[model samples]
Target: MTRRVPARDVVVFTRLFATMIGAGLPLVQSLNILGRQTEHRGFRRVIRGMVRDVESGETLSGAMGRHRRVFSELSVSMVAAGEAAGALDTILGRLADFLEQHGALARKVRAALIYPAMIFAVTVPAVAILLVFVIPTFESMFASAGVPLPAPTRLVIAASAVVQGYWWALLGAVPLPALAVRRALGTSRGRLFMDRLMLSVPILGGLLRRAAVSRFTRTLGTLVASGVSILQGLEVTARTAGNRVIHDAVMSSRAAIERGETIARPLEESGVFTPMVVRMVEVGEQTGALDEMLTRVADFYEQEVDTALEALIAMVEPAMIVVLGVVVGGMIVAMYLPIFEMITAV
Candidate 1:
C-alpha cells in the first residue's frame, strides 16, 4: 500500500480539508470523505489510515506523524498548534497557501533544468554515434583515396579510432562515476562537499543559492506564523534544507538564538545570507514581526530565482546549440576538406 504522494495532491487535500473543517464537519467524517474523493490511490489510503487513527482516539498530529513521508514536520507542527488553539481550519488554510508557493518554486527550478537535460541527452549519443560509426567510414574512404588528411580530419579520425577501439571503456566511463557519486552522496561528509561544490558553480549556483534561501525563509516563516516555536521551526527547516551548507547556517543561527544572540548575527557571520537579508532580519526581530519579514524575504528571493533561471536558460540554449554545431559540423567539414581539395586539383 506504499506509493509516493505528490505535492500537488497534498495541496489540494489541504485546501479541501480546511474548507471542510471551517464548515464544522466532524474530523473523522471530513477525513473519510476526502480520502474517498482523492484521485491518488496511495494518498487516499494514507488519509483513510489517518481517519482510522482518529477514530481510535489518536490525535490528528499523532496520526500525521506516523505518515511522515506524506506529512512534513512543519505541517504536523502547524496542525498540532491549530488543534491546541482551536483554529485548525485557519491554520490549514495558511498551510495550503505556504505549500502552493513552495511547490511553485520547486516547479520553476525543475522546469529550468529540463532544457539543459534534454540537450545533454541528445548531444551525447549523437556525437558518440558519429565518432564510433560514421566517422570511420569517411576515414577509410579518405585513406583509400591516398589524400593526406588535414589536422582537423586527422584529429577526428584519431577520436573515432579511440571511440571504436575502447567503446567498452567509454561505456564504463559514464556509469561508474555516476555510481561512485551516488555512493558518496549517501554520506553526510560527501553530501556536504557536493553541496559546497554546487554552491560554488557559476550561473546555476546563484539560482541554487537563491532557491535555497527562498525555501528556508518560506518554511521558517510559515512555521513561525503558525505558532510553532522558533527553535523547533529552525530544527524542521534544517531537515528540509537540501543543501548541507545552508543547513549548517540555519542550525548555527538556532544555536545563536539559544545563546541569547541575534538570529541575524550568526547568519551574517556564516556568509550564506546577504547583508540586506541580515538587516531586514534584524529589523524584524526589533519590530517583533520576524515571520512577516521572513515571508517578504522569501518572496523576493523566489523572484530572484525565477529571473536567474530564465537568464541562465536563455544563455544555455544558444550555448548548447553552438557546441553541438561545432562538434558535429566541424567533423562533417573536416571529412569534406579532402573532397574540396580533390575537386580543385581536377
Candidate 2:
C-alpha cells in the first residue's frame, strides 16, 4: 500500500526537487539524493520507488502518478504540463508556493478555533462534575436541615440524580451525535444540504465562503498559468473544492464555457461568485489575462478571510466567557441561597 505523505513533506519535496533540477541535476540523481535525505521512513520508501521508476525510463510525472496517495491530481497535471513545456523546475517552484499557501490558510483557520475548543473541553467536564458529585452532597445537607429548598436548588438536585442514574447513556450521548453527523456527511444529498447550510450561517458563513472562493480561484489560476486548459483546470478544481456548493458552481461554469459562453456569466448566475469577482473575470477574459486576474481575486479574498476570522475570534471569546459565567455562576448562587436563609433565621 502507498503511504500517505503529509502536506508539509510534499511542500518540502517540491522545493528540494525544484532546486536540484534548477541546478542541472539529472532527474534520477535528484530523486536519489532526496530519497537518502528523507527522514520519514514511509516517505523515504516512496522516494526510493520513484527513483527506481525514473531509472527504468519513466517520466517524473508518470512515476509520481503511481503514488496517488502522495501526489494530488493538481500536482500530477502541473508536473505533466511542465515536462511537456521543458520548464519542470519553474513549475515545481510554483507548486511548492501553492502548497505552502494552502497549508498556511488551514493553519490560520484552525488557530482561530483552538481557544474556544479548549474552553469547551475544560468547561464541559467541570460542569458535569458539579452536577454529578458536588450538588448531591449539598442536597443531603439541605435535606437533613429540613429547610425548604428554592425551585432552582431543587431543579439542580433533580438534574444530579438523573445524571447519576444514567451516566452510561450520558457518556454515549457525546459521541453518538458526532457519529451520526459523520455518517450523514458520507452521503451526497447530506453533503449538499450541509454545504448549503454552511454558506447560510451567520458570521462563520462569510468566512467559509471567502475561504472557498480564495481556494477555488488560486487553484484554477495556478493550473491555468501552468499551461493546463481552462476546462481541465475547472474539472480538477471542482473535485478539490471541499464544498459541494462551490464544486457544483464550477461544474456549471465549465459546462457553459464548453458551449462558448463567458466564464463570468455562469458563475454570476450560480450566485456563488461576488459581483467584484464576476466583473474582474470579465475584464480578464477581455484583456487575455484571465489567469492573472484570478490570482488577484484570490489575493483579495485571502485577506478577507484573515480579517473575517479575526473579527470572529474577537466576538466569540467574549460570548463564550459570558455563557460560561452565567451557567456556572448561576449554579453556585442557587446552591448557597438556602444556607444564607438558614443563617439569617438563627
Candidate 3:
C-alpha cells in the first residue's frame, strides 16, 4: 500500500523518538507509541512495520536497516551499537541532533537559491512581454509614422519577428540538448570527469568541496563513535558520502585500512583531500581519538560550508543583477538605437 509522507511530521518523529528514549521507555513500547501517534499515513505505516519487527524479536537496528532510505547507515549503525551497549537513548539523541543539523543546512541552501530563482522567473516574463508584444507595437508606430528607421531599430524588429513567429522552435530545442547531456553524465567516466570539473569551478567548487568534507567527517565520526570497526566504518562512510569523487577516495582508503595501512596515507595518495584534513586525521589516529577528531573536522567543515554558502549567495545576488542588466539593457539599447539615429537625422 502506498503511504503518504509528510516532511514536517518526520521532524516530529525525531523529537518524539528522542523524548521517549530519554524517558527510559522500553524500545518496543516506544515504537508502538510512535506508530500510533503519527498522523501521516505513510510514516505511520513505516512505523507500524518497525513495531512489528521489534515485537517479532528483531532489534531496532535490524528494523531500521530494512528501511535504508528512511534510516541512514550512520543512524542504523549508531543505533545498533547503542543497542549492543545498552545505550540506545544516548545514540537516539545524537541521531536526532545530526538529522536536525542536516535539515538546517538543507534549508539554508534552499533559502539561498530562492532569491535568484524569483528574479529569473520575473525577468523571463518581462523580457517575453517586451519581445512578443511591446516591441512589436513600437515597431508598428515607427512604421506608420513614415519616419526613416535607424539600423538598430530595424534589426531588433526583425529579430523579434523571428522570436514571435517561431517561439515553439526555441522551446523544442531546450530539452533535447539537456537530455543528451544527462545521458552523457550517466556514465561512470563522464560522471567522474564532470565531478572533477565541478571541483575546479571557482566559487561553487569551494562550497561543494566543503560540503563533501562535512558529510564525510560527520558520517565517519558517527560510525566510529558507534563502535563499528574502522574498515567497516570507512565502507559505510564511502557509501553514504553524497559526492562520488570523495566516496571513491574513501573506498580506496577502506581497502588500505583493511590491509593494515593507515587511513591518511590512502587519502593523501588520492589527492582529493586537503593537507590540513589529512594531518588532522593522522593526528587523530596517533592519539587514539579518531572519532573525536572526525567530529571536530565535521564541525569545522560545517562552519566552512556555512561561510562559503553565505559568500556565494552574497556574490551571486549582484552577479545575477549585472547579468540581467547586461542582457535586458543591451536588448533595449539595441532596439532604441535606430530610433535615436533617425531622430538625429531629422
- Residues 1-346, candidate 2: write the lDDT tens digits: 8567788998999999999999999898898899888888788988899988888889889999989889999999999989999999999999998999999999999999998998888788888999988998999999999999989898888888988999998888989988887887999998998899999899888899999999999999999899888999999999999999999899988999999998888788878789999999899989989999999999999999999999999999998898888888888888999999999989
**List of clashing residue pairs for candidate 1:** none
lDDT of 1 by residue, 137-195 (tens): 98888889899888988998999999889989988898988998899899999998898
Tell me how far the alpha carbon of residue 4 in candidate 2 is from the true structure, in angstroms, after superposition: 3.2
| lDDT of all predictions | 0.90, 0.91, 0.82
The runs of at least 3 residues in candidate 3 whose Cα sits more than 4 Å from the true structure, single-residue gaps closed, are 1-8, 142-155
Better of 2 and 3 by TM-score: 2
lDDT of 3 by residue, 53-171 (tens): 98899988899888765666777887888888887777777777777777778788899999899889978987888789888988887788777766767777787898899999987
Model 1 TM-score, all chains together: 0.97
Best by lDDT: 2
Which segments of model 1 are wrong by more than 4 Å? Answer: none
Q: Tell me which residue pairs clash in candidate 3.
A: none
- Sequence-dependent TM-score of model 3: 0.92
